[model samples]
Target: MAERPVTDRGEVGGASAAHASRGDAARRLWARPAIAVAAIYIAARLVTTVFVAVGAAISNSRTGGAETIGSLLMRWDGQWYWVVGVEGYPSELPLDAAGNVTQNAWAFLPVYPAITRAVSFLFAGQYPIAAIAVAVVAGYGASLALYHLLRERIDRSAALWAVAFFAAGPLAALFQMGYAESLFLLWLHLALLVLVRRRFGWLYLLIPLMGYTRPGILAFALLLALYGICRWFRRRVDPLPAVQIVHIVLLGLLAAAVGFSWPLIAGVVTGDPSAYMETELSWRRGWTGDHGGFVPFEGFIQASAIWFRVWGMPEAWGYVALGILVVALIALLVFEPHVRRLGVEIRLWSAIYLIYLLLVFFPQSSIFRLLMPLSPLYGALALPRSRAWRIGVLAVGLLGQWWWIDQMLVQGTTFWQIP
Candidate 1:
């Protein structure tokens, strides 16, 4: 080769040094947790936006190009949220011809819609714009919270991987939709982090936010109750102080109060003692006929039988399957090494939340969205050191994201296709 121009060092050495400098800079940039989390969240949101665009295009094509992306994003529960924001919940609950309570804005909580309505002033009073903005922004915060929460238990690399999975997993489209899930998740992750760090004081604020953002605060209260019991049992080892015990008790009570406060408010507004419960049960009526009253765990059992019969299986098989599932989950939390790696607080929250869901939620297409709270378990999936395993999980999650968007957003033309 002709003589390469080099001042002091050889050409190869200079080029190598330049490459090394660039590599070091890249490492330094990635070392910052916020930057890495933002990068992951931004990239994932872009992918989800593409998926949403594809769904919107497909939906419009099917509907003679009449639907816009905003309308598509504002479908299903989004419409309900908008109604809650603009019109407000009715003083009188809507009733059907049969004199049963019907679905109304009371079924949806106030926080997300209230926030969206306020933000809409910035977007020319367009609730859709404001809703998506809130969801997207809260989703980014949730991602950061989740990364830090995982970091409390796992290594930095694994925590980042967990966030990657969470941001790109199935139902990721909710982050860009008009739903309250993203905001609720933000509060939930922060609440869990504070709980893990023994910062019970933060929960006084978080509990109300979570209670109004979604219906899962009761489960969190239950978690706190169990957490206190566990602390008491392990006090010899962990030394649960008197102050900490008082926090646990007061927070548990505060969370429970807030959790039940919405129902009480709905009852007061509508002049129907069972207004909120009846409104929620109105949704389950579509599948199970008419339920006379709200009963814990009854919805799941009835839904299991109904779904199993629809699927051409014996109804008893559904009960058996439910039993098996409960056992399997208990085993996973108690025995699985990967899950144990996520630490006790996460595992306890998962168990409590699952129990709460089983108690009140009817099994439906929306169950997937409801299960988003258990996302901390994703850390377990990211724990294995095998590169192939991590990549496989990530690939599967993206594929699921596309499938969920298509099924629930694009081709969701029927009642059961609710997201």
Candidate 2:
């Protein structure tokens, strides 16, 4: 029947060859070094999972806490997100017996909870599983983006090692939990990538989503403003069109406006324009003594004094110690050659974020999570002159990750811990 049409085998062989070529292309893409970073990320995650599971199982025997892996992953902030996912934000802010507003869903942003709620619907209402899946998947995307960013400045091997360090960092366990750190980090890295590429228009879109995710949107806006100013100066020498200058100014203002919108929304919902800042200060009302005022950064100094005195140190010395630590960390972050390697925009972001943390946030055990944006320093750790040193740093980081999980989640301790 096919005498007129060549044998069907010939057509079949052509189709097979086409399929083979496509397969080869996929293989080539997978072989890329950045993809290897993702592979390393998966391996580190598996190791952490095994450790957390074992820790939980052992702890369950003694404490009868939620030893199941799923339960353990749903600790701390994850619980708040779950509440928001199942029950939307409360119509009224909760008040304590003393009449002060208590912890409410408004304290947490809606982005992570909204995503978890959507995923839970797809899973037939397995909210915990849905949240964990979102975090894990987002963590992978973040690792890949990190590798690409590092690769822009360092070699392939170093980039891989850097990603490994980031995945095994002290608070890396947060990535495995049903928390929004991974989601926030994914957006953070993506925004940085756009900024590094000088894609300002993308930020006009990204700042709004970031505003929904965290109140730290203003930090990024400040970073972009400073960067734009520098670029504007450079362009003055070379010169650009009046329209171009106007576009840049308008975009900068718009980004900052969008960045502050979330706080304004929170204020509106609570029936007080200053509700956002007032609510943040409410957490510090639990301090031990006449520690300090309600002003920004005062909580940090006050807490330092209380923490050291609890350990039997004199309060005055404790204040001195806190002063030294702040100065040293600021010096290190500002002067570190590694920080310098990140280029002007990223450096600006880091500097602004640090200042924002100092001025607005309090000192807490959860400071590690607050500092998660600095994970790029892991790339510097990957660049020691000796290979053994790099391996040592990564090994220590993984060990710290395991220790953090064991202490924070497995032990089920509630004595002023931030888990």
What C-alpha lDDT values do all the predictions have? 0.92, 0.76
Count of clashes, each model: 0, 0
Model 1 clash pairs are none
TM-score for all models, in order of appearance: 0.96, 0.86
Compare the candidates by TM-score and give the number of the best one.
1
Model 1 vs truth, CA RMSD: 2.0
After superposition, candidate 2 runs with Cα above 4 Å error: 1-30, 233-248, 288-294
- For model 2, what is the error of residue 120's alpha carbon versus the real structure, in angstroms, after optimal superposition? 1.6
Q: Mind giving the per-residue lDDT tens digits that candidate 1 earns over 148-243?
A: 999998999899999999999998889989999999999999999999999989999999999998899999999999999999999999999999
Error of 1 at 349 (Å): 0.5
